[model samples]
Target: MERQKRTTIYDIALKLNLAASSVSRALSNSSKINAETKALVLKTAVEMNYQHNAMASNLRKGSNPTIGVVVPRINQDYFSNVIAGIEEVTYSRGYSLIICQSNEQHAREVDCVNALVNQHVSCVIISIAAETGTYGHLQQVLDRQIGLIQFDRVVDELDTFKVINNNETASLEAVSHLIEQGYRRIALLEGPQQLDIFRQRKAGYLAALRQHNIPVLEELMYENAWTKELGAVATAKLLDLENPPDAIFASTSDFSALGVLEVAANKGIQIPKELGICGYSNEPFTELTSPSITTIDQYSFKMGKTIAELYFEQTEGKAQIKPKTISIKPKLIVRKSTRRK
Candidate 1:
C-alpha cells in the first residue's frame, strides 16, 4: 500500500502564502515570530494534521528531551505513584517520559535499558530488578554519558544519583512499635536479601530486637516471603510452631501483610489480640483491610518528584556534580492491626 504523505511545515507555508522559515519558527513557538502570524500558522498546521518532527529537531540540537524510567512493576501503587510524580515535573520542562516494566527479571531489565540507550534518551531512572546481580548494564548508561538516577532498590556500588527511603529506620520504628504494644516473639516476613533494601529492613528488625533486649530467633525470620502467597504459607508455618510469634511484621510489603491477615482469619485468630500484624509501603489496601494494617509510608510520589528535581539540578549547572544519595525518611503509620491495647 502506498504511504500517505505526512503534513510538513512547507505544506502549511504554501497554503498560507508564508515563507517556510516563518512557518517553522511559528511552529517552534519562537519569540521572533509575531503573535498574529504564529496563531495563523498554528491553526493552518492543525487543519493540515501536521505533526512536529521532534526526533529530527532533537537530532539537530544534539539532545533528546526524553527521560526513560524502568521499574519492577507498573501496576504496583508505589511505582505508579512514582511515575506520576516524575511525569509531573518532566511535562512542565517540555520533556517526555518512556516507562518500562522489568517484571522483576534481570534479562528484561537489561533489555529495557539497552532499548532506552539506543533511543538516545536524555536520562534513565531505574529501580533495579529483584534478580539484578550484575552492574554492567547500569555501567553502560554512565559510559554513554547518560544521566542515571536510581531510586528505592539501588546498587550501592554504582556512583549514580540515588533517591531512597530510609528502609532501615522505618523498619526499626515499625518493629519497635510492635514491641511497645506488648507483642513479643514478633515474626518477620522478608523479601529477597540480594537487594540492599531488604537487607536493611532485616537489619532494622534485628536492631529493634537488640534495643528491646530480646533474643533474635532464627526460626521467626522467613526469607523470600514478599508475596501474598509466600506470606500466607509462612504465616501457616509460623502459627503451626509450638512457640508461635505474638506479632508478625511483613517487612516486604503490605500485600504480604494482607496474606497474614487472611490466613489468621481462616484459623480464627484475632488480630492485635492473638496475632498483631504490620506491613511496609502503606499501600491503599492496607487501610481498607479488616482491622487495618500498620505500615510504613515511603512517600513514593514525593520520592519520584525529588528524583526528577535532583536530575535537573545535577544537569543544570556547568560545574561537575558528584554522585549523591538522597534519603527520604519513611513514617510509621500505626493502625488497629498492631494496636494490642
Candidate 2:
C-alpha cells in the first residue's frame, strides 16, 4: 500500500559506488564521462527506475519553457477550447502548459498569476476575473519582464498584448437581427457592468436600438443576469410585466440564453413566434437544444491559437515590439430560436 521512493542520481551513485557528479554526467551522456561508465550508469538507472528532473534542471538554468494560462473555468466550453488551441501551438514548439482556473474571483486570479510568476514561466496568458478592481498583481508581471498577454475580458489600463473579440460589434449585429425579425420592445439579460466585455455588449445593444430608431426602455434591461439561473429569474419577471418584451437577448452568455429558452418553454411562450431569444458565446449545447439558440460564435479556439502564436511571435520571436491589440470579430449563428418571419 505504501508508495515507492523515487530513484535519484544519488541513489544510482550509492548503488554503483560511483560519485553522484559522475553518475549525473553519465546520465547526461557528457563527453567527460567515458562510454563504458555512461553505459553502466544508464543500465543501473533502468534497474533503479531513476527518472530525470528536466524541469528542475531547466529552472536552475533560467530557461523554463513553460507557459501559464489563467481562465475563469475550464468546465466551460469557451475556455476549454481556448486552452486546447494554446496547446496545439505550445506542444509544437516543445513547450509545456500550466493551466489554472480563477473561478471568476479576483483573489484567486491574483493567486494564480503569482504562482505562475513564482514558477518563472516564459509567459502568462489570462482572461481576467469579473471582479475587476485592481491592477497591482498584473502590473507586477510586467515589472518582472515576464511576457503578459490578456484576452477577452481585459482591463484597459494594462498596456499588454491583448487578443479580444469585438464584443460591441458582435452584440450590435445580434440585436439588429432581433429587430429585423420585427421584435420590438426587446429585453436584455446583462452581465457585470464593471467588466469591459459586458459594458461593450450593453453599448452594442444600445447602439442597435438607436440605429433602428427604437426607444430604449430602462425597465427592460436586467443587470447581472449572466448565469442561467439569473436569466430565468429575469425572464419570469419580464414575462410577468404589464407590458412584457417580445424578445429577450441574453447578451451575457449562452448559458443565460439557455435559461431564457427554458423559462419561455415552460410558460408556453412560442419562441420566435410570440417571443424571440438570442445569446452570446456559441456553446456546444446551444446547437443541440430544441429550437436551437441564436448565438454569437467568438471563435474561442482560434482566439486561443492566436494568443499562443502571438506570444511566440511577439514575446521572444521579435526583438522589439509595442503593446499590440488583436481583435477578432465574432460571427452571428442564426438558429431556430430566433427565426421568425
Candidate 3:
C-alpha cells in the first residue's frame, strides 16, 4: 500500500517545534499569527507539497468563498470590465467568481439568478436584462439572505443595494450641450422606456429641451432603438422627414450612436454642421470614430469596484443595517460629434 500524505499542519508544527495552534492560525491566515511565522508556514507548506483542503476549510467556515455574477451580455466591453474589477477584489480575498450571461432575456435572467442562489453564493451581483422589469427573481435572492448587488442596468422597483449612474442628470447635460451647440431640431434614439435608466434618460432629454424652450416633438422620439441596427433604421425614418432633426441624442449606447453616424454619413449629411450626434456608455470606439462621438462616462469599472466594496461592507457587518442603495453620478464626455462651433 502507498504511504499516506502526512504533511498536515500538525506535522509541520511538530517538525518546526512550534505550537499546533500557531501553525493552524498561520495556515488559516489569522491576524493573531506573526507575519514572519505565517510566511514561513506558507513557504514550508509549498515546499512540503501540502495541498489545502478547501472543502474542509469551507465546511469549517460555513462559506464556499464564491460570488455569482449575472449580466445581459458578457461580450460587451462594459460588462467584461465590470467583471474584471469584481474578480480583482474577490480573488485577493480568496473568493471564486461564477459568471452567467442572460442574453437579454427575462426567463434566462430568472434562471441564472435562481441557479446562483441554489449554489449558495456569498453574493450575487447583477445588471438586469433589458427585458427584465420584474423583481421576483431578485426578491428570491433577498429571501435566501444572499447578498444582492445591482449595477448599471437595474430594476427600479427593487429596493435593494444598487450601483447606478446618474442617467437622468447625464442625459440632461448631454442634451443641454447639444442645444448650446446651436442644434435646435434635436431627435432622440431612445431605449425601452420600461427600464428606469432609459426612462430617466428620456426625462432628462425632455427636461433639457424644455429648459432651452424647444418644442417637444413626439414624432422625433423613437423608442426601442437600443441597438445599432435599430438606431440606423430610426435614423433613416427621422432623416426622411420633410423637416429632419438637426441633432440626435443616441441615448441607448455608443453602438446606437455609431449607427446614427453611419446613416448620416451615407446620407452625405455633415456632422455638427447639419447632423450633430451624441451617444451613451462612452465605449472605446467612440473616440476613434471619424468625428468622434460625444457620450456619457459612467465610470464603469469603478462602478464595479463600488459594487464589490458594497458587498464586502455589508458582509463585513458595517452599520448593522439592511439592504442599501448607492448611486454613482455619471459624467458627460463631450466630443466633436456634438460640436457645432
Whole-model lDDT values for every prediction: 0.94, 0.93, 0.88
Cα deviation of 318, candidate 1, in Å: 3.6
Cα lDDT of model 1 by residue, 1-341, tens digit: 99989999889989999999899999889999999999999888888899999888897788999999999999999999999999998899999999999999999999999999999999999999999999899999999999999999999889889999999999999999999999889999999999999999999999999999999999999999999999999999999999999999999999899999999999999988999999999899988988999999999999989998998899887988899999999999999998876
Q: What ordering of candidates by lDDT runs from best to worst?
A: 1, 2, 3
Instruction: Say which candidate scores most in lDDT.
Output: 1
Off by over 4 Å in 1: 7-50
Clashing pairs in 1: none
* Cα RMSD, model 1: 3.2
Q: List, residue by residue over 254-299, the lDDT tens digit for candidate 3.
A: 9999999999999899987998999998899999999999999888
Angstrom error at residue 332, model 1:
0.3
Cα-based RMSD of candidate 2: 1.9
Can you write out model 2's per-residue Cα lDDT over 204-302, one digit (the tens) per residue? 999999999999999999999989999999999999999999999999999999999999999999888999999999999998999999999999999
Colliding pairs, model 3: none
- Global local distance difference test of model 3: 0.88
Candidate 2: deviation at residue 28, Å? 2.4
Of models 1 and 3, which has the larger lDDT?
Answer: 1
